[model samples]
Target chain A: MHMDFSFSYYIGLAGIMVFAISGAIAALEHKEHHHDVFSVFFTGFITAIGGGTLRDITLGNYPVSWVKDENILWAIFLGFLLVIFFPKLLTKLRNELFLFDTLGIGIYTVLGTRIALDHGVNFFASALLGMISAIFGGVIRDTLMNEVPFIFRKEIYATACLAGAILYLILNSFSTNGNMNLVVSASVVVLIRIVAVRYNLGLPKIKIF
Target chain B: MHMDFSFSYYIGLAGIMVFAISGAIAALEHKEHHHDVFSVFFTGFITAIGGGTLRDITLGNYPVSWVKDENILWAIFLGFLLVIFFPKLLTKLRNELFLFDTLGIGIYTVLGTRIALDHGVNFFASALLGMISAIFGGVIRDTLMNEVPFIFRKEIYATACLAGAILYLILNSFSTNGNMNLVVSASVVVLIRIVAVRYNLGLPKIKIF
Candidate 1:
């Protein structure tokens, strides 16, 4: 198994960094809960890596990526530090954070789909894993914070990831260049999420009483 | 790999059924969320099997138990149907439910510890896995329902499981009869939990702002 250390890997790292920041930002919403710094740090770190950890575990990928790569831990630590020192800075950079968060989802969706496919899962299962990888971190974060998962609420978040994964499978079938598939699929996820949020488009909520 | 198809296995299956019922009972609290039947079913199913799935994945135990044994799925399905048809029945049998829930936790704790130890992890790690297996189903259920985890609250739940796991390790060192070890350890967990709840014993809550 020849591992490629290339541009795409860097993008994935950047995605991890952004996801960590988002996790920290989400943790700030629970200030009234009186969470300690370690609590905040753990939430951010888990939020950043939870999805990927589940993905790896399900695919039988041992020594999960974060366990193998200490850089991810460093990135999460940096996120925790930034949140601790400049808590107000996150509120100021909301727009930028949103953009980075969208990008992170896109990058993770493509990466997750590719990894699941590599593990010999069917395309449908791979797409499901891709979406789970993209959104579960936030789900875990919100759950810990005692809030309904934002994706499960009236949001187009997971749908975008699902669409991107399907697009990736389609692209992979047509093209042999892995880089092109990654770029195109990730872009699709980012675009869909951005457009949906901008236009306030959302899935219809089901109410069963 | 000699698998035992005996009383312990039947107890495990019963544990799964009770856990699924507990999950459905929890979901009933989310009536205001207006979740559909599918949502309720998925919640019940995940809560019953989530911990074991995580344990199997971490131990590289392929074809997860529920995935291999369709009986577990049927049990979860039965739980869902019961919840849907007789929502009030759960509330009526609260004491019975509590007893079954405690028993389920004990059974899962022993099963998880044994599996982790079988995978060559250290005793400490195995014990940790044991506690996680006992409590994580409820954690996942609470998270999905958008509430703070009951285990993390002022509850002696996970602590009881941890103590039982330690006792299991100690007994396993001295005894060669696996059945005796299982029964003793699981009984310890059930007794501790019942005593704790009856006496209103709990851990002190930490408030860190």
Candidate 2:
């Protein structure tokens, strides 16, 4: 599959940047111990690329994404540098972080579903993969931070990704314009996630004895 | 690659079972909340297959092992059932659990290294993959349980796997007897792990302010 230098591609890069920033912020918030600069940088790098790495691996995509694209590595490295030099900038840019993170969820969800479809995986599985790509990085970051994943608690995060993936599949079936489908589906995910967070909407928690 | 239903295959199955049991025990030992049977089962399944899944994905090996083999699924399922029915049995079988877990580390290390070699990865990379396959499941299990990974903290777990992988590569180079190579490498890992636990030998903790 040929990927053009499209708007979605730029959005994906922005997503990577924000994810790395969030990861760095998480590391800083970790009150257990003082992590060295390398540990902080490693955590950010992993959080930025972990989900896509898993997606490519599951799909048997060769060379993986970051391995093929040095730019992504450079982007993450820049994020690490930003965190090290300006640790308080993250808090100051909280709203911007939220915007970029939500956009990232939408863009990653569409990208993951499209890749899986290209591999000829079934629709249901493709959507699942899409959700995994969008959320698993945060899952990994939270896991490494030794905390219960936020998605499992008080967020409609993965649910929004699932919604967007399903919407993308449905739209793709009718539309021949790939960019249109990408924009519509990603917008739906971003809107849903933003609205969910705005109104404090989330799935009911389950408790079993 | 043609896989014979050989002794190593049986050892791999046994490894999956023990890994699953350890995951269940971890879920039970979680102090924060009560996990239901499904939670216990999910944790066990992830712990049993997580490392191999990651390994196969990284290698771009399609139809990952668990996806191809129904028997492995059944083995893990049996482990889950055993845990659910006999929650107290783990405490009673601590010594047995330790024995099987050690054996698992040995077998998984060799299996991972052999698969990487089959893919034509260089020795160092193959050894790294071998260590990942041997220890990553427990890392996932521990992370999910909200603890610092045992391998990262106070254990010689990954060291044992690394040593075993190097031994396997050296043995394979010197001798063409595959079974003999497998036995010697796996024995080294198991012996190292057992001795480490018995004598409380571990890497020194690092602290950076």
Candidate 3:
């Protein structure tokens, strides 16, 4: 079944850039320990693509995400180069990181759900995939930084993505407008995240017994 | 499609303990940064169980590995308690980390292959699963620590796991006793790893331009 590739591609690319910038900003905090620009760049690249790659492989796709598209590599490299060459500019604009990351999560969630649906997976599984795609990279980033994953910590991370995926499926079942559904689903996630952050809302903590 | 549960449980338990210890040792180097023993223990728990959990979940096994047996959780907790109480002892024994990690790769690789085969997956897929099961936790740990994965960097990590899995399959085809085949295959991996570490042997890097 052929689908509209361009729409998802643009959304996915936007997600990558946002993830890259957030990763770079996170790495900047560790600048006191002698982190090179390359390290930050690579971290961003991994954060942007890591989760999606894992999702794709688990779904049994060959050549993986980064391998199949030269654009991904170029985007990552350019993202890093820009951050490296313009550290002051990036630092000043660091406040925008959360906004971009939230938007990225929204886009990635929709794209992941769409891909899973295309693969003939069930709705619940597609939603799961969507959340995984959206949050896995950030989880990887947090873990690498020796911190617990953001999803497992503060912020409405994976939950927002999951809600968005469910919304996407619900919209798709009732309507023939895929693009509108994607946008609506993504907007749902972005709005939820923004409100959650603004209100300091979060999931209940797991008790260790 | 019922399988023997007794052997699987013991093997899986041993695998968790081994992986947990390796995680503990890896976390020790970061103690100077105020990373407490509890953090170390949690890291160990995730490292030990993460791979198997991912393997089972992706393979469509509900309830996951640690969820099926509460012992896994207790084991990780006990493992952490021991490390916390005997910090100096563990510090003194740091040299054994590589040996323990190598043994972990062997056991997990064999166990993963066996489980995949039991599920009626083909040899190639089973071997791939084995490789994923063995290396993925470490990969996750490295990513969390902001280090490039060991499998992606120095040494033939995943390749050794692949070799062990293939050998297990070969021996099974030859009508070897199951326990004996596991031992032989594990031995092959352990020996390869020991030699690789001693000789600084590694896979040739893939240069992407």
Best-performing candidate as measured by lDDT: 2
On lDDT, the stronger of 1 and 3 is 1
Q: Over the stretch B36-108, how does candidate 2's per-residue lDDT look in tens digits?
A: 4545655787799889988988887776776556677778988877776775676688798788888888999
Q: Where does candidate 3 stray beyond 4 Å?
A: A1-8, A31-33, B1-111, B115-209
- The C-alpha RMSD in Å for every predicted model, in order, reads 6.5, 6.4, 9.3
Which window of 10 residues has the lowest lDDT sum in candidate 2 chain A?
Answer: A200-209
TM-score of each: 0.62, 0.63, 0.58
Candidate 3 TM-score, C-alpha based: 0.58
Q: Can you write out model 1's per-residue Cα lDDT over B1-209, one digit (the tens) per residue?
A: 13467777777777787788877666556744434453455567779988888888777786566645566777777777777777677668879878988888998899889988888889999999998888888888887887777887756899999999999999998999988999999999999999899999887767798
TM-score of 1: 0.62
Off by over 4 Å in 1: A1-50, A57-103, A120-129, A140-149, A152-156, A159-209, B1-50, B53-100, B119-128, B140-148, B152-209
lDDT of 1: 0.79
Per-candidate chain B TM:
0.93, 0.94, 0.85
Q: By DockQ, highest first, what's the ranking?
A: 1, 2, 3
Kindly provide the TM-score of model 2 when superposed on the true structure, using C-alpha atoms. Answer: 0.63
Please give me the DockQ of candidate 1 compared with the native complex.
0.17
Which regions of candidate 2 fall more than 4 Å away from where they truly are?
A4-47, A57-103, A120-129, A140-209, B1-7, B10-14, B17-21, B24-28, B31-46, B53-100, B119-129, B140-148, B152-177, B180-209
- Compute the lDDT for candidate 2: 0.83
Candidate 3 clashing pairs, residues 3+ apart or interchain = A143-B144, A144-B143, A144-B144, A144-B145, A144-B146
